[model samples]
Target: MKKMYLSVVFLLCGAVLHGQQTPSGKVFRAGAATSNITPKIGTSNNGGMQDITIRSIHDETLARGIVLDDGQTRLAIVVSDLCMISREVLDEAKRRASEVTKIPAANMMMSATHTHSGGTACPVFQSEPDKDYGKFLSARIADAVIRANHNLAPARIGWGVGSEPTQVFNRRWKMKPGTPIINPFGKEDRVKMNPGIGNPNLLEPAGPVDPGLPVVSVQTPAGRPIALLANYSLHYVGGNGPGEVSADYYGMFANRMQQMLGAEGQDPAFVTVMSNGTSGNINNIDFGGKAPDAVLPYEKMRAVANVVAAEAFKVYQNIKYQDWISLSSAQKEISLGVRKPAADELVRAKDIISKAKKPIMTSMEEVYAQETMAMKDYPDQVPLILQAFRIGDLAITAIPCEVFVEIGLDIKQRSPFKPTFSISLANGYNGYLPTPEHHKLGGYETWRAKSSYLEVDASTKITASLFELLDKLEAANH
Candidate 1:
């Protein structure tokens, strides 16, 4: 009888210790709203034309850190409200943050919101000069990291995927036999036939659309929601008419979420961060068929933001927290072939340059022009960085540019983990990475120009590299 009692006691103690060994997470919110950067109004046909001004909005970074009781490993998810995150800059930030927090560099996953209306834009291609916007951006980003690290406390995390179809539309249009191609911006006077319409049978409707909106919520030990991170691929097009830099629709969406779950509302202590997914060819506006009579107003943009926020909250309400925690990460370098201008293509480019209407010259235009001239003298190769992180059941794969929906879906379909999300414009901006099909279609996204200098094969090679990283992560975990 004594031996049996001792054995039972030992079994109970083992169960209790195992249960207590689960890792805990914490949520931190930091924001810097002032970006001295202002848009160069009226520079292009797409430049600001309406009287929209940003008085005040939320431009935030949310960082979530997960640490095991043993402290052997730490993982963090840092989301920023910006157009892009350069690998060099992000590496420096990671080095600094890791030095301070002791978190491994590979364990840090940093991503951007891809907000076009945000602070000074980074260089998209080698043809574009690197903007000095980092002077103001670096300090703000570092402050966010410090604040997030300071707010670490015990928490529980839950994740779910919600669908919102009406909010996103395919911006690229396919050419069909006898199908009229309308102007993208809806000005009937601007309607013109697609210049490359000879091979009509080969062209198809724009790329695939990803309407999945994944929400990840972290709550305090006491059950108060501390932070919510939502991922989607739609490009931020709500602030076409802008002023001083702002976070565009991403800010609006966060505001709506705060109001819905804040103290005065549902009273959840929720801090929301909107992360951009593979949205190279995705937008809120449908560029196909007939164009609208007028541009989408700010009010319409706000409405769209609210709808997305509401759908995200719906997913948040249905989450179930898990206790199993495991972390893994991998990074790889990929080479994308250079798209050198052929002799004939150079002649054609010169012809277009001679006839194309030039906009008013500003300091910004002069800088861009100088960069364009320099690019003509050289051929450049784009380096793609693929990074992946696993936090329990949630897996994050980071790609360096605006990726097409098909590529995003392909990654998700092949991922060994559930609820996988691809964060785009993360760690770098190498322009749009369209699939082979979209590359053949030859639209604004796939066109190789001064601003978009990457070759079409770059997208394919990067996609393959990311999949290989995913496989390695799965193998390590098992």
Candidate 2:
């Protein structure tokens, strides 16, 4: 009887020591991992009106993820280096990851970094995705989550906010009256996108910029950094060499964060993720300001990365890491009307394409003409996935579109959680999400194309759904 009792006690101790629990009654753990997602040379790259064939690689792209388990609940957040990812691809990734880690498919939040030079993963304008590359990307994203789950250990988590206002500028401008602002559809517009730098015709920016840089840091019990996920509202800094594949500034920011935090040479390498925020109408250029001097191929992006990373490092110094934090996720699919072209517009599109001289579309009119025909076959309504995750007092919302800065600002202002930030281009890629007011202003982002075909009220509906999820999360926490 004495021997049997001793054996039972030993078994119980072993169970607790083998990652089932920490010394404390509740175990809050986190793990982070990265999966290389760099596409092969000669693969298609998106982010321009025309597709680019990759000729050289400037840097490796990655899908960096972090898994957090708070005794009862588990949540995974992943950020990938790509222009945009489709719903089907992300859904498959979530399914594969769930099968391995037993984390509910809804509990994982995955988003693209919106790097213009990264591998093409979704069709935008004339750029089409490479089907094989999409499949490979899905598998790698799932692998990232599985690996992170396997590495879970007792960890600390905290969040802080930083601001770098100098880098972000609203790219849409209200041109002087009678300035020829013809859109692809040959309609006049009040605002123009990327209107020349220091052009006297420029009046002012049509929208405001969001300069918030929110950082979420995870670390081991011994204070070794596990991962740091940062969100910024600046669109990609695009100065890469022609036909060169890169993760753009997103990957650069990750590397800089790792170096600045002194997280080099650890047993498990430190992973840093820079997720795109609401930057659909934001860019690094100042349209109304003086044009910057000519820069080397990757110089501009590196400069932007350093500046943003420096701001993040400042916020990192003041983070208050907590040993235990509640984690919860809620997901919902909402259907919104698609702004398909009307009968007259479709006819005009077909006419334009039929009369085009070049075999491939080279003019703006030809590109948008092709887009109009594609939109004609789209369903009247399409479902979109909206997700919200709660990490202690911090809230992170994910939307499957290139969101506008105003929407993000409104969410932060109204969210029940303090210092809330959103990840755009998440789970799927729809198109640019401009507000109804902006839509009325008739800018490039509002033109009817696959790249901007969301209904006028899509932003309103999305925010309503997100608030519902966020409110539920907050109530449950209290």
Candidate 3:
């Protein structure tokens, strides 16, 4: 069945940057490294609202860093096998990396792959970030960047995109009017997430999917692969069964692709980093919940990794090396307000909260009830990190929330660069940022949890801010 699927190159941008010269004669240099980031025993898993356990390692989670330099300017990006990395930890990791490599804090972009099976990061609205694990992950990330900085050699990179519509999809669905479920606001909503299909009440999905798999590959002058980083807008393909700490398909995809595309040399050959794209409402599971044959947990992950990696190899073959390229990076802090419930609704929230003797969130609505009350303690406003990086005609945008595919697609469409993409779960975790229309429809994505707290128009504001930065980067090139 998988053989029947064919993927097309979404977009391919090939250009040169001749801004600076290096001793090696190549204008740009690249290097990559990976640091094992699997959590220690007893660390809490971060996939769900509950505190799930990590009994063992299905596979070692990793923090993969890639550094690119044009002699005069340098920037780094790190992809962690985490569910969601907290703002505090992300900032600290960037700070430490800067101290060693001298890459400005704003020039570093870090993001978790949103692997549900991975261990806890600096969580919001609760206990402090896991002190030991947080430090370990941050230190490892910084070290990886430093190592990549050390190993930097004259290199070349190319960009392209591929499609896997069957493997990646939107999980939001519109339900029948009569079937009403309680939303975070404690009111009925027309749309819901994962609305099972057997119920015949299912309508079309609430949103469209962006199955664009954009890849950026770095290689030595001789064309030996050094690192390949890809961004796909689908959320994780569920974790390794239960009780296992795996990097989910994101890691598996990278590992498998490394073998398929990697050239022989080092023990691991080259690093393969698969970064999660905007997928707040996307996943591999059959959310409509009606499939003739159900795929086993690990099997589904392997299938996704195989198909995606196969497509990436195809993109890899098309990229030709460049001797010189320009690099630029910038960051900004966007102020956003946490969404609040109405005054009278808060009374109802209190009533709902009073029923529970302890904090045990069962249903989705109950999860919001607890989170809504917790926001009373959160500052009225929060700072979100928005960043952009330019590699010739390719532009990268970093947003700190579980951004929906619509916003990502909008950025790509409106981008001045030929090939552009945005990454979510970078720099901070603020939950889901649905488009304005989805907020009005009211679904699980718009629900108030540790994940989705920003104001209704946050999607609009953040999108605008990101575009503004991209404009600056493109203008500077001129």
- Among all windows of ten consecutive residues in candidate 2, which has the lowest summed lDDT? 15-24
In model 3, the number of clashes is 5
TM-score of every model versus the real structure: 0.76, 0.96, 0.91
Give the clashing pairs for model 1: none
Cα deviation at 393, candidate 3, in Å, is 0.6
Model 3 sits at a Cα RMSD from the real structure of 8.7
Q: Lowest summed-lDDT stretch of 10 residues in model 1? A: 184-193
Model 3 lDDT per residue over 428-478, tens place: 888888998998888878877677778989999998888889889988999
Clashes of each: 0, 0, 5
- Candidate 2 yields a Cα-based lDDT of 0.91
What residue pairs clash in candidate 3, if any at all? 10-161, 17-325, 197-288, 431-451, 431-452
Among all candidates shown, the one with the greatest TM-score:
2
TM-score of 2: 0.96
Estimate the Cα RMSD of every predicted model relative to the unseen true structure.
7.5, 2.3, 8.7
